[model samples]
Target chain A: MRLKLLGLAAAVALLAACSSDQDAAGTGSVTGATSATAPTTNAGAVRPGTRQDFEVNVGDRVFFGFDQYDLSPEARSTLDRQAQWLNQYRAVTIQVEGHADERGTREYNLALGERRANAVKNYLVARGVDPNRVGVISYGKERPAVLGSNEAAWAQNRRGVTVVQ
Target chain B: MTMSAFMTRCDRLARLAVLALAVLVAGAAAARAELRVDITRGTVQPMPIAITDLLGQGQSEGQIGRDISAVVSADLERSGLFKPIDKRAFIQDLVSLQQQPRFADWQVLRAQALVSGTVEPQPDGLVRVAFRLWDVAAQQHLTGFAYRIEPKAWRRVAHKIADQIYERITGEKGYFDSRVVYIAESGPANQRVKRLAVMDQDGENNQFLTDGRSLVLTPRYSPTTEEITYLSFFNNRPRVYLFNLETGRQEVLGDFPGMTFAPRFSPDGNRVLMSMAANGNTEIYAMDLRTRRTQQLTNHPAIDTAPSFSDDGSRIVFESDRGGTQQLYVMGADGSDVKRITFGQGRYANPVWSPRGDLIAFTRLYQGRFYIGVIRPDGTGERLITEAYHVEGPTWAPNGRVLMYFKETPSSDGRSRRARLYSIDLTGQNEREVVTPMDASDPAWSPLIP
Candidate 1:
């Protein structure tokens, strides 16, 4: 009880010190409050159809290999889970954003990203998901999730991310 | 040269002589065309040139005169064909040169070409400029011109004078009076703000077309230079958009079912050739601007992008993966007689046909490095001009004598990368970085402004 009160006091003091700087503390306090009353808020906070729930529970993205649109067994399994989750929510439509690593040229990378996205969409349709409920976009190496030029960064960058609105 | 072409040039010279006869009488040897610049070879010894300041009688006049003279000198020196000598080495002033050019004074400094001019402030808020080009070694007058323009148009007037000098000496058109459209980028790598921008070829008068609210890419100028076509991700849908400079009217090119990008103008500027991705396949298409009709050029399942038309509009050169790897191919404008043109070791893409129609510029990616290269139309005489960690999107000057491309260099242990624009001639020498306000890419050079 005493620690929770101190944490709240610190967050309030942080807000008063600098409102702009409290962006970091804002999230820290939320996490602290949730942990304090873990049992009640944990179940109530799980909005099943929310983007956070979809990302945490349903796996909203899959990875790809270097210069290849062919999905690996692991990526296929992730898409399988995605299809199952998406089928449960019939009213939701998702856009699959196809991305490529920065090792290639712009125009060609765009094509490669398109191929990867269609590969994901085809997998989902084959797994009993409605084709019309899904759309795809190829970012073509324009946006990267990571900011380094190494292999680890490239591996994370080559991906197909699903978003729900 | 053909007999008709030679005769046509002779007729032009005759006309010039007739027009300039009022200023002064021409000697017999003055009519002979000499001091030619051979641009065919890969290396050249720059011809020494002497550019005298345009004598202005007043303060503002002299300032404009000096500015105009400096611009002309910079243009000539940047072409890598002439070396403008230092002004401190001058023995004869513009007054003396206008009165009587002493060939011995210029010859002593090894200046084969000498330029002398004057700026006269007109009565009605205009500037009257007259200039002369002399061949010092031959001791003969080459050419001269006079113009009346507003003081605000001094930069353009300088470029025009340089164009005249270049045309008289090299027998080709000049690309100084031109503009380039590019994508200016800022912010982090993941959340970048790419805006469409246009600037003078010398990196002046820059203005942003888009407010950087939406992501834009790959802007290309039409032949008339009055319109630009580019790809924009507006409202989360990528489409091709056209902006008219004169009217400030913007519109989508056409309603396509998929993403449309890499749109380039044909020789006549009536149609835009671009690539569209749909149904898990990418193909090339041409849309006629007037009728709102699109013609699918490539029907292959493989990727076909970066289509550029030839100077005569009879053929096109593009990159296709139909041959298992990204290679360049030539096809008729109607999508017939498709022939593979590149057999090099690397994957070649971004093929732009030269304005002269003699060579095609392309980007080749091999072993993790990119190269800007040129090859013949018949798939012969391949030459790699510049290489870097990442360089692509080569655009041609109006004269086809120089190429501008974007190069991305890594800084600080390959964590952050920066893209900058660069230009290099066919000779592979005199490579220069074009300065910009921010990181830039996807440079598209426009034809000389009409």
Candidate 2:
């Protein structure tokens, strides 16, 4: 009976600590709770919260090569560098988008782009990234990197891009 | 000698009795196969039309003007819709190729409609042809246009005239000025190499789009744009993707948990309607673009695929086998109010709604014969448009005046096959093969890519 009481007391203390820290964080405050315990990794919840901050903001662009969904060796290296950068900003998630050149039809391109984005996802997962930390979608041929009809433009258009989640 | 003849007669009678018994047994086992189908006769009257031969600057212009005009007249006449009046019967001189026509002279010729045109030569050696469609009954200008094309394009110019006349009378758009996209097949049948091909509706100006590393099928174009959506076995998973003509970009669609096929654009160009197969049954789904949302439209356990939306996107026409056999069904875009549209003797597949919203074209299979037919939305006026050994996948020309479908013919080698694209007017006339550099199928007609 004494040991059971001790365990309950420890749990209460931890909950109190987490509540107080959430209060301090301001944006993630929890109300109606006893507030006197230490905080854990409460920010790692899988559910979406404060989606406005997760909007695809500017300066967070991704790139790919012509008619290829499989990332290039250089692309993988660049993504590795980006992963390191992401590690420093510990609170952010991301979305990966795949695209294709406009020579083909529309639906096929959409499926192709999805494959390319998933390729990036596979690489990131293999590199020890959390699968839930990334989401993927395909824009197909709807969006283009460059707006020209020549080969140079098409080569640039086939790509997968990373955006801030 | 008399005894030998009697023995031979007895032997022949015994053999005849045994043959008769065998015939009776075979007849009893023969399959009794038949379906009572009510097929209504379509209108046999040819569409009234007029084609005026363009006069040239002088006799020095030679046979070019007459030849071009004659070819156009013949094409229209062969369509079975138009009855082109004889050029010699033209009451008016229309002598000046560059001037407007005297409608009164055409009226005197008893032409219900009048096609008058002029031919001239540009300084760059190109031919400039001008044509106009006049409605003697309505007493107004129907359609008029001018084209500056190479001398070799004269035949196409002729086709354009016929297309315009058909559209003006029918209140539908003309399809003669468009092109068809199909898979060109070559090499041995088992190891056939298929490539993406594009050609004019009249079998002119054929070009290969893809080199055929992967298999492609069922290409469909945006009703108003140059974009196309088709099923490609590129990675061998059978996914749907988009190919853009202008930017030459290809992008894959959603990463479905299962195989995706039979994709088409919503009339508004804002969403894609497709079928995703899971557990051996296919269901229809729609994806909205502006917001990344997917909606499952049909939850039936049957094979519900090949969904085509009406012009306004309010309803969709698709093929389903919910009736124990493959037949066409019409339902609301959200998958409510399912109504059977075809009650024919055979199975119907590949139902494509016309751009004009007045007709639906489909492929029907019956008793070892394949047919292409069109029916109105209410299931009235059902008409079988074409019959062949094997025909499938009917696509409409932009104007909905012509249908382009593929036919497969048996080769000397039973295992080998040849596929070719053929086009015909909605009136079921003027059937001609759209020649490709190689065997082709799964044709999709694009709107004039200006």
lDDT by residue for model 1 (A17-126), tens:
44211221233222322111112333444567654456556666778888788889989988998899888888888788888988888988888888888999999999
lDDT of 2 by residue, B1-450 (tens): 322222232221111111011111122112211101111124445645567677666553335567667866765565555678877777666664235556677667666777777678778766667776666655555556676665655655666666766555654455665667777888654245677666666666676666777666677776545567877767645677887654556777788875688888887777888987643356888887567487998887566778899877999998876776678899998889999989989778878898778999998888767888999977888888898877878888776767889887865533346788888778786678877777888898876533
Candidate 2, residues A136-161, lDDT tens digits: the string is 65555545544444455556556665
Q: Tell me the lDDT of candidate 1.
A: 0.81
DockQ-based CAPRI category assigned to the predicted complex of candidate 1: acceptable
RMSD of 1: 7.9
Q: For candidate 1, lDDT tens digit of each residue in B333-391?
A: 99999999999886999999999999999999999889999999999999999998899
Which DockQ values do the candidates obtain, in the order shown?
A: 0.32, 0.01
User: How good is chain A of candidate 1, measured by TM-score?
Assistant: 0.74
